[model samples]
Target: MPVPDPEVRVTAVDPHVSLRTQEGARATPPRLRDVVMAYVGLTKPRIIELLLLTTVPVMFLAQRGVPPLGLVVATVVGGTLSAGSANALNCVYDADIDERMRRTRRRALPRHLVSQRAALVFGLMLGVVSTVMLGLLVNWLSAGLALAANVFYVVGYTMILKRRTTQNIVWGGAAGCFPALIGWTAVTGELAWAPVVLFLVVFFWTPPHFWALAIRYREDYAAAEVPMLPVVAGARTVARQITGYSYVMVATSLLLWPVAGTGWFYPTVAVVLGAAFLVESHLLLRRAAVSDDVVDLKPMRLFHWSNMYLSLLFVGVALDPLLTR
Candidate 1:
């Protein structure tokens, strides 16, 4: 049985007096709290934090472990705001699919915490403000790269590739990789191979990191028709891909020493840490071989550790110059 729609009733208390009433009238109107949470969801603070973590280290390495304080701060702030804006725009584009996924159902647009129009407006405003701040406070090169990254993520990746193919993250990873180059350019006012190496590191690292996550939430992705690597390629394929990329990441980390000119601490740490990363990747590969497997929690653990790995690895770069000297 279906529930009835609200019924309107009118009654006359007296010959000339009339009263009208409606059921289900405004049960708890929208509140300021909901609006604020929507803004937070728009920003994607966790993603911004991770992106800026990659950004700031490039600044330090660009200036040889000593970037100008103002430039560093500006780069981080502008990068964070710009990345946040890009994420919000992505939310706007993916709202329909997000509503279908349990993981994303509570998001601002999906939950009606914020309207699509409001999100678009806020995203664009943040982007413009961030671009201006970066140009005025940082450098034109950094600003340009930041703008490009935002455009790539919102338009090229989120709007198009995401729905079209599983390689979305492979190409889209380029957007996040830009922060490393942007950070380097912020301090040096030019490009070089060092940041490029860092960019490659993150670019290759992205697939495994995201695939691991997608593996954990496979059903959600399947339900949403997201076309993630795990959905298109299958778990076994994704695991092998993770292992292969882990090897590439390790090999690339070793090259940073000569290319980026870091101290002994880096290679020593790189060899040890890189080996551990490989071990984790192999574990994921082994676990993914089973048929009808739902999710690999262990690989998810590795995915989390992989994030910590990159952060600590970059920190090694900053500390190497001091520790070795």
Candidate 2:
């Protein structure tokens, strides 16, 4: 008889689970619900949804309508796996800071729902599987982009820049922008200006979206000693940067109309959504300027609106091709 992999087997009682609580401690058998959710938590599934939103719409625009079913399925699955791997690795790496931050204190690692070693191995497995799936089912270009995104998120953002820079999310957010490029390349098997422009839109949008959250959790980041912009800088400074990035983000979205020769839907959505984004960003800035009211900045108002803006913009991206065709 073949021997099972020792690392993946906990005890003879359960051959499937190797998860342990801590060093030298006996791991009580995890409840079914807890075990399921713990692994699901590793993927950060909500973030994968946000990442996929940018992906599918671009595939529609790239193909000028719905792409092949096989292609769409392959790309989406590959992207999800790749992103999950990156997020899981981030959770493992940031376990310490995560324990200190209010928003992250309940995460799996901080709560000891899973061992750090298990999380590390899970992340590596997903990363490897995702790369192979994309390479085999889609094309190597899409596969390569997916692999690059995972590496950038794990190494560039989580391991390196996250703790060291106030500009962490600004640059590190590039990892999230790869979905657009991946979506485009998945169909056409080549890079082009349209996807590159859409990639920039997401890249610019990330800072403001993230900074609003940073502003809301400035205290948490400070407590954890992570130098997010709002944690290290004055509220006014952070708000100004958010406003600046919002301008570029909106402008980049508008450029997509011209660059892709997209129809009225995209341009109209761009104008309307861009205006709302500016108003909210300016409102946050005004709130920040009130010295006593900085604590009540309510940056989440803009944060939530930014989410809507991206969703609507991408919806228009998908619709433009169908309507124009």
Best by lDDT: 2
RMSD of each: 10.8, 8.1
Q: Which stretches of candidate 2 lie over 4 Å from their true place?
A: 1-28, 292-295
Top candidate by TM-score: 2
Clash tally for model 1: 0
Candidate 1 segments exceeding 4 Å error: 1-26, 295-297
What is the C-alpha lDDT profile of model 1 across 17-46, one tens digit per residue?
111121123367669987898898778777
Model 2, residue 117: distance off in Å is: 0.8
Worst 10 contiguous positions by lDDT, candidate 2: 1-10
- The TM-score measured for candidate 1 stands at 0.89
| For model 1, the run of ten residues with the poorest summed lDDT | 1-10
| Residue lDDT tens for model 2, 173-280 | 899889999999999999999999989998899899988877777776787788988887888988999999999999999999879999888899899999999999
lDDT score at residue 17, model 1, on the 0-100 scale = 18
